[model samples]
Target: MWKIGNIYFIAAVAVIGGALFGFDISSMSAIISTQPYLCQFNQRGHDENGLCLGPTDDVQGGITAAMPGGSWLGALVSGIVSDAFGRKTSIQLGAIIWIIGSVVVCASVNIPMLAIGRVINGFSVGICSAQVPVYISEISPPSKRGRLIGFQQWAITWGILIMFFICYGSSFIPGTAAFRLPWGLQAVPAVLLFLGLVFLPESPRWLAKKDRWEQAVEVLTLIHGKGDPNSPWVIRELSEIREVVEFERANADVSYFELFTPGMINRTQVGVFTQIWSQLTGMNVMMYYITYVFTMAGLSEPGTNAVLLPSGIQFVINVVMTVPALLWMDRWGRRPTLLVGAFLMCFWLCINAGLFAVYGRAPYPGEFTSTAESMAVEGPPAKAIIAATYLFVASFAPTWGPVSWTYPPELFPLRLRGKAVALCTSANWAFNFALAYFVPAAFANITWRVYLIFATFCAAMFLHVFFMFPETANKPLEEIEEMFDDTKPGAIKYIGTPAWKTKNTRNLALRQERNETLSSEEKMGVSGEHKESAA
Candidate 1:
């Protein structure tokens, strides 16, 4: 049977998994303020103006958070499933789960049912989010690996932009269909992903680990050699993979406990913290609840296009800004991109917070606790806050957004790659669940102070990236392991080490020299065999 062997096509298909994540993000953000959504899910009844109100800030937060809660559990188990079944099958299972979860969410009749459905959907997202990057990284060539893995983030932004518009359009429908329509449509990308997986190749590294050497070489040849099994590039890559796999099989037992040994712990910390700080950047708060941020910025009319339209622009910016990362992350490298992004994100958040503090006030006079109260910051300062929010998204979309997904999966050894990435991705979902649940109440009581907290987080992450994270661009997966094999006990060991330098390309030169020697030997052997046959 014919299957896709082209790297770019495979990446496009795999990243639909990331798009499923995008769909869930804006699925609620776009429709949460519509009357159909509030009337059906908000148990607190209507206000004096006949508009519906939520039962409380906590209830609403829970409804928003239910998916990520399920996602955290899903991420935890994804490693086990991917390791046992292979990367392609694991993603296919996630797509199936997402379709079922979408049905439950679309048909939900109450808050509990709604939350239950979101959790199920979250579980599917968890599996996809954890494994998709691993699958892509394994299949991609080192020189283009960052860009290909970056396609996952670009897909996510496209998913957000597309789903937000879908929900925005549905909001005009007069009843439960407003929310139900978009929820039902969430299954479309999952359906496409599952079907697409039918024609995609499994991870070559997974094949190598399973001792399917012939199949692994075939896949590597197809992906990197354009069908030439004897191509020098293919031979070198296969040789490198076999060497690492054999060494790992002889030296180590694969287990979750392996992630924390003294030698492995630094790589593990870098992997896990890369994800944790991505969430700590508080970008999802923008994706998941842009409506609330706009409301606080004085675009307070909940169900109107005015509020929804501004958010659509933010989503567009997210999609557009991500393109540069996909094109240039290898050139820019991971460490500097992350450092610059963290500082810029901190700057934008501080600007937003300051604007709100100076010019904003609470809409209700007494103690604030629910969506019933709105922030009364208006006029030019409100516009500035909105502008700053846009700038924040711009900084994040290009830098941390794609790098977060690309960095972790490439950090660990082949034996530990799946589980290590799963743990790292779970950290992301864990924080995602917390912020999704907490932000509504934060908006009600603390208001602009939330931005200040995230700004501080960004500042801390800037230092973290500078001091701890090493450069990992333009090097083969096997070569990346060398950066973390230090005898020193702490990350400070990387401060002036060879691994810290962004321009390190010594490994590439060594690999090229090895490939040349092997090619010359092959030519000589073929000539000698012809002479023997003639004799």
Candidate 2:
């Protein structure tokens, strides 16, 4: 509730930038197969029903892939902007860029214009996508971090659900305005994001990193203790942060290469691969091309309403399950949630592929006809395939969808958090780029077998998590640094027993020092600063 903490309001509003991010993602899906979309670019041999009579797979891929491409660049460079101008200001900068891109997309008259606009808008998302999680994570307390950080993904899904409905409604209008109107609506979120950040405080950790200690302390008190500068909890947080930031400053530099150093490599691997697994879950096949998937589902008329069913199912399930994810993450722990999700996703993908392998038919090329009405194997087979797709969505929505975005930021130390996030996010968009570029051609060429490949990847991801990932459920952020400093093999799984988890010799010494300082402060009758208490 807004009454509980200002960080909730700040984080909730700041991440509307993610709404524009989600808007661009699903917007093109609505228009791509529409008559106006295909005809506007002058596909010389394209039929009126939206299928190209000539080779246009690559063109379609370019239109869809441009945003991820732009996102890649924006993510790589976002850390520079975020570090130079604080997190709030960086988000504002990204919103301005998003609005510019939305204008270009709304006014697009051809395929090139459309692609260019998507890329530009995508660049803005890249910046937001990279920074939003980091910003949310920084302002949030260790106790409520999961719920707060997860809000960015929730905002993204809300944007997606809204845009999908908008597309369904706009399909009634005859002509390009149907798509143009929706494209321009993105400005609503983008502008709202810009205006909102003007009031939000900068990320306190970033202020601490910049050595603006007074501002950092002030912001931390405001968010964590309702503006009580002398709150004992705030003092403990400041001391804990000082330890981590001081260590990071002495040893770390903000660079892509720094992510791979021996001390930080584990964090880097977890961060990067978490993102890769998020992409390989095969979620995008449905996300960006549900219309195509439905058209092939043997429906007589794959109208907007018909297609809307699957997209709507996905959005609704995504919104519904996100709440449980926030609740379960802190209690059930990260590794359990992710591994179960991976296993279930693999199960669903196999079912999806098997149904298609036996009962489904590849879509007819060169004719966007309602041929499914006359096809031999209709009815249950198509419905079964749709069911399998929804099952996959159910498995993913509660788990990988939010975990991927939330977990990676927690992996990095605060000093290099911005760049580290950007690095992993680029890895995410990189795989997304590959999938978007190849999925169309794969559908045209291989059909149902594509699910088999993703299923295999899902299995591999499950194994990777079992071996590589650790359980960091309720531990303080500073304690996470000590966990990674441990070099023993399979060291992460040693949750309650290991030196890192047990508050080993080094931590024991720190505790003793904290007690001595607290004793001295108590004697002086001044409690403005307090030492961190043992967990």
Candidate 3:
């Protein structure tokens, strides 16, 4: 494997956990709405005749929310698990957990059984969500780091898109198999992930940090330079790993409290709140309850197929937009992406709120209410609302979705990286849980007014990124520490500069670009010579 190619293969396989996480997202939402699921568990209860037994809003919220609650605890503990067992093993653990969860959900006989299953599966997702990006970030070369980690977010969206279509197909299934078959199929990816890990190598940097220098050098040779131990690039990268490890070993006793001190608070705030704003972008609101939102937007057809239009639009647009976003990520500064996304998200939400207010009257079905109560708008206004939602998803998928996946692992120093990322990931799930639980009530009570609250948060987040979050594009992990150092009160002048323009990041990016060009030229020259020799 020459030039990090092996790293890409491993990352792609490892992020299967992310795909399962994404599969669970749309699948559960799709299931809870079906007549079989509702009739069986909706708490409205079946008479001897088994009629009028649709699930209550509370049951809907519970089934939808169970995973996030488990995810929060899973994320909170993932760092410790990774640190104790290494990144590869943590991934394996998650896969095993995923298999168990899928079994429970698919076999469920009641709401409690299904909810318990969701929570278990959520635990698997929580661990993978935090650990996968960390693993990818640790293994990736700085020049290609953003793109590699972006794969995890891409895999997640891919899973969601595929699952939505699967849900579409499953809608034709009669009885409980519509949901059960999809839940069972979700386990396939987890099994693949577990089997794949048996052959892959651990993170070279983690091996170095644990004082296994020989193994680290061996992996570095293979991934960085096709197994040439004497290769200059291999030697240089290995040396950097050793140096980083030594530096971290000297300051290795990191505590959670230390993250809040004056010298570290800015980094802490940036890492923690990036996750917060991502959820606040209202992306999950749509993701978790797109069926409800679509119904309110006046989309309907017979069976679960009513979801086909909105779900298809979401899947295609997200999968397509995300590819280019990853390409632009390292070249364009991270701060600009956040700021732009926040503004556009705010704009779209405002438009949605305005359209709903003008086109539809009150008795608006709140967030918690059924679509029957909320589907008041018709014709053009209804279509406009649907368009607004797609726009919102468009703004979000490219910006917050992938950026949130990459930024946290880049924010902390080596000594505290694991804990910080784990904590930050937990924050993401915590907010996810809050919205998953409360959005129903929010929609039911305030209706269109709900968008106003999220829109305001988007405005605040944009300003925060402009003044508070320093740009981190193209900087090496060590250079990131220098950027945070300048965040102290007396050094605030450096905060707003584009990371690409900062002295360290600029020099590094230029060097990386030059090397890449030379590499391309050399390969082309060799190709030309080979053609001459063959002829």
Q: Best candidate, lDDT-wise?
A: 1
Best by TM-score: 1
What lDDT is reached at residue 458 by model 1? 98
Residues 1-535, candidate 1, lDDT per residue (tens digit)? 5778988999999999999999989888887777788778777776666667654678878888998999999998999999999999999999999999999999999989989999999999999999999999999877788999999999999999999999888878888999899999989989999999999888989999999999898887777766667777778888988888988898889999999998898889989999999999999988888877787677756445567888889999999999999988888889988999999999999998898888988675322224634566778998998899999999999999999999999899899999999999999999999998888878777877888999999999998888778888877888777557553233234434743464545367457746755775687689789999999
The CA lDDT at 332 in model 1 is 84
Instruction: Give each prediction's root-mean-square deviation over alpha carbons.
Output: 3.8, 6.0, 4.6
Candidate 3: list runs displaced more than 4 Å.
1-5, 45-53, 301-304, 362-375, 485-507, 513-535
Would you list the clashing residue pairs of candidate 2? Answer: none
Arrange candidates by TM-score, highest first: which order? 1, 3, 2
Native RMSD of candidate 2 (Å): 6.0
Model 1, residue 411: displacement in angstroms?
Answer: 0.5
lDDT order of candidates, top first: 1, 3, 2
Q: Which model is ahead, 1 or 2, in terms of lDDT?
A: 1
lDDT of 3 by residue, 401-507 (tens): 88888888988876677778888988998898888887777776778888899999999999888777776667767667656765323433444565434432545
True-vs-predicted CA distance for residue 498, candidate 3, Å: 9.5
Report every candidate's CA lDDT: 0.87, 0.75, 0.78
Superior candidate under TM-score, 2 versus 3: 3
